[model samples]
Target: MEKLIDDEGEIYNSISPKVAPVAVQNEMEPSNISIVTTNGTADNNIGKSKTTISLPSAAKFTNAAQKKAPWLKSLFQDECSAWETTKCGLAELIGTAVLVFLGCMGCVGSMGTPPSSLQVSFAWGIVVMIVAQSIGHISGAHINPAVTVGAVVMGKKSLTGACVYFVAQCLGAILGYGLLKVVTPSDLLLASSTSPAETFCITDLHGKIPVIQGLLGEIIATAVLMFMLCAMWDERNANNTDSGVIKCGLTIAALCMGLGPYTGCSLNPARSLAPAIWNNYWNHHWIFWFGPIGGSLLASVLYRSVFSLPQCSLPECQSLNTQKAELYKMMYGHGDMWDTFLSGMAELVGTGLLIFLGCGGCIGSLGVSPSHLQITLTFGLAVMIVIQCFGHISHAHVNPAITVGSVVLGIKSISEAAVYIIAQILGGILGYGLLKLCTPTGFLSSGGPEAASTFCVTMISPQVSNVQGLMVETMATMVLMLIACAVWDIRNASNTDSTSIRFGLGVTCLATIFGPYTGCSMNPARSFAPAIWNNSWLGHWVYWFGPIAGAAISASLYRIVFGLKTHDKETLTPISESIHLNSVDTDKSEVIINSWIQYRVHLTTRVLTLGKLIRIRAPYTRKKVLNPCDKFSHTIARYKSQNTTFYIPISLRCFSRMNLITDLLMRFEEFQNQVYRVRVSCKHLKHVKQSKHDQRSKAKVHNNISKV
Candidate 1:
């Protein structure tokens, strides 16, 4: 129902029925235009502006008719039967059993008469690695039933299969544990620590860490872990590109290791339950089960609501949606024009969040410094959590002026600079507003050196002078930015996710090194959020001015000075830049970005040869420009024919067949991923004819596309 673009001459995302022929739009466009095939666009979405369109469903074929067209079902059935074969299922079951055994074995070993943190931690993680590798082919080896449950709750899996998976996992865990009990030596059991879980029960009975704190810990940890899972599983996440068993394995393993000490890492109830049962650590079982499960449920709802994008309503799932309205479009900060606006807004909001959580959190109104150790750990952890919360959305810039400075320094844009700054300032005050709603005056009391009693207040003293603090802040920002750019390049527009956890820990490490000096305002936004919130805006400029100047100077210094900008002109990493717009401006106002190409297409399809680049407009019925060496053959397969090459998902209807300039386009991201894309050919079209169920969408996917 949006603007219908005539690329060359193909209908990109309109309602095109299989048998009900429709007239294709052909005039008022320029010679720069060319038609690309719509042949079963892999996705119903045509362009980045995918709009939802309702079309009449295909008429169901009768038995007689189906018999006449035997190819319909027969051709679509699995050939070698990969991904869902019985062999895959068996491999999954065995893999699940192995994971349970090893994870339990590690616990048993760690809790043995002589407990070892590293050994136990590694053991639990190793199970994830081993099993992920073993059954990853058949099933994404989700060994723990709870994780499967989490996945289903998160909508990554179906309820029916998740239920079956849980049952299988429970049975496997029981068997693995039972076997261990039989094989274990009594001496080791006697020596083990009665499970460090006793801390939850010790409960200074009331004052120190009330039952609420323990519950909160479990909730927070579980939620963070679940969020990480979503990012890692995202096919779009550069970290998850062509996701194999290894990436998934490392993801779980890293989570277990990093978060193990907190709430005993009960992100998975199965991991906790099996060990707790054998160890008799059931007193706080509710904290582990209810808390984590509750958190998981909340995280699922939030993620799906806020981040899980909806499929386009376009006839096909096209990347360049024909709809110009904002409702159906997802705008990123790095994207052009409107995208840049959204990106700036995101920066503002994200930075505001950063300031509120990191700085506000640092000075929890506890005028006293707990043993230096506690201050170092508690504050550092708070920063880690905040980073995880907002990293993906705005690159969690949480700082307005860093990019502004980058822009001024020629690394970013100055035209829309005000937007980001305003967003950042507002987000800071907003965080302060929310902070007031919580925090009892008592919790604000002198707990440690960083506490500010005004509840919303941001000012406080420091161990060092402002200059000393400024230097430290600048140094810290330099480190964080480098790591940030490395992990997330705006040009690449991708986040390292949990893969580059060392970068995440880097913040904590900085806090440990510089917490005493000016409270180490590595991020200007971090410093500003609390200042605006607490009404203690005095000396606010120091936090804002100091960190901003430092970040800008450092971002340019390292990125430009050292040639780190190879990723993007902006020192910022690309959490959204993973997608590049390789556009072709047909002067007719049509632009087409090959979503599947190694690089991005910036031209809107309306400006290019519609979605098809092969055929010209009706007035210009020029001969085809096929390559002398079968270039036309490949371009057809890559662009129109959806048999084997990478193409954009146009829609359910358009995917079946396409006619356009089918050609192969290739490029690579900083990580060296070779993206091979091309148009479909007649031979490829033949393959699509034989396939069924979202044929166009399947062809557009970037994975192992069949032979063109």
Candidate 2:
């Protein structure tokens, strides 16, 4: 009969009803056990069935059960969290909505006697900056669909997640435009429907701006925007710090300002599509989608593949890093109460000065209409003065954007930054309060929104679309940040003496170009303080969003082109200096440096401690020593801990060999009448081992006998 066996290998015998237990068979070897059963086929009449089972040895079975677990799958799940995806999508939505709505409001106010580009820029730039600051912590505020595509192509985001973001951003854009429509008058909307304008969806039948040129402009501008974004976000880049998101907003604002006049600077597809859909204007619609996407993709590919930062191999740079680490640890990890207080005060005082001087110019101009140059200079000069006054103290980072940028580059600590920002905000309120004291109440109220604009960040025209103003601000802020980094680069020697003047000139230049459109506020603090004090929040987000985006872009560009290398030659240096065996036996050397002694001493006595040889000259003219032996030993121990090295100068012709002891005693006694003190070098010294005490004794005796 055939045998039947279960998965556990317990065999059953149908032919033998009273068979040995399966356990007894299992205990025996496989060859010793046998199972007998009925015939293979089941017999219906007899009701008997048969089966045969084969099994691997228990050793082999246990091994097959102990295979490696699937760790890679678990890791993948951890890396891609469902919560993170949802958060990113939501942030994109809010960020886009903020950018679109404020930008539209700025456009609504752009139609005036002169059609100021400055007011339009201000409205758009601030929106970008604020949105970045608000939601940048979540989704990176990639409100533009072009950016989303670039991110995905660069492998920073998953295709599915990026698609989700794009959908959210488009919806957010529609929502922003809807809000703009509700606030705008129908008559004004009709007059400035943008269907007849050549802003976003180029409707110009004239050949002045050929469709090709418009497309090229979009490609170039969007390329620059994407290039900056990639540089800032690259983890390999040393300069891509904590401030990356804000800098991105600033970079966009700068690009927007510079390119607004040409092809309307529609660097974002979502931005263009939002308003186009609202007004039912679709002239040359392909340019917006094709140009930005193509440009951004090109930039992302080129930057990721072609560009790299310069490496540093200097010993000095290594030493500098060590010192920097010490300083950083002291300031952040173990900072005393006084340092924190000083840093806070520096920010407070510096910001106060900036607002008082900057906003004063704007308010004072109420009586006589100041030119854009005057306003720009006022703001730029204010920044310069604060920078110089507090540069050493607080880094004079009166602007929050600059502070964030510095932190990202690893130049500042987060706690210090928090304190600085808080101080500056409070300082801003104080500065505006002081301005109120000087200006007449009637003048402040008489102009209403027009008058309030002088003391606040507001839109001045309504002809430009929110998208158009945002683009202008983005371009302008980008230029401002680019120049700011250039001037601040320590490697550029020419910038050393004229940093303040150069920075002031740079800001003034930006304002002159973009001030008429949007007030040219590259600094968020400069905008926020005035707006808060004046109680004017219209289009305020543009100021924050634009400058921050622009700055983030600049941070990336600076890092890729000029950031310091992570691996340095100095870091490879041995932690402690190695002893030179060859130098010790050289007859050419007479004096040795005693790192323990701060001041120079003659070389007469050679003492070897723990294998380190130290030569000391004692001017002994009398029986008593000028310095106590215990005190000298303590000094040596202290110097040893500090890694200091000392060199002693020796001269053979100064004394006869046989009279060395007598001469040294006489000299030391004579020196006792004078005040001879020791000095230590500012730099740390390397350790040199001294010989054993018994060895030193033997050497002295041998020298004395030889001389005799």
Top of the candidates by lDDT: 2
Stretch of 10 with least lDDT, candidate 2: 680-689
Q: What is each predicted model's overall lDDT from 0 to 1?
A: 0.45, 0.53
Q: What is the lDDT of residue 442 in candidate 1?
A: 50
Candidate 2, after superposition: displacement of residue 653 in Å?
A: 46
Task: Estimate, for each residue in 617-642, the C-alpha lDDT of model 2 and write its tens digit.
Answer: 32211122343334332222111111
Per-candidate TM equals 0.54, 0.38
- TM-score for candidate 1, please give it: 0.54
What CA RMSD would you report for each candidate?
15.5, 29.0
**Best TM-score among the predictions, by candidate number:** 1
Please give the distance, in angstroms, between residue 420's alpha carbon in candidate 1 and its true position after superposition.
4.7
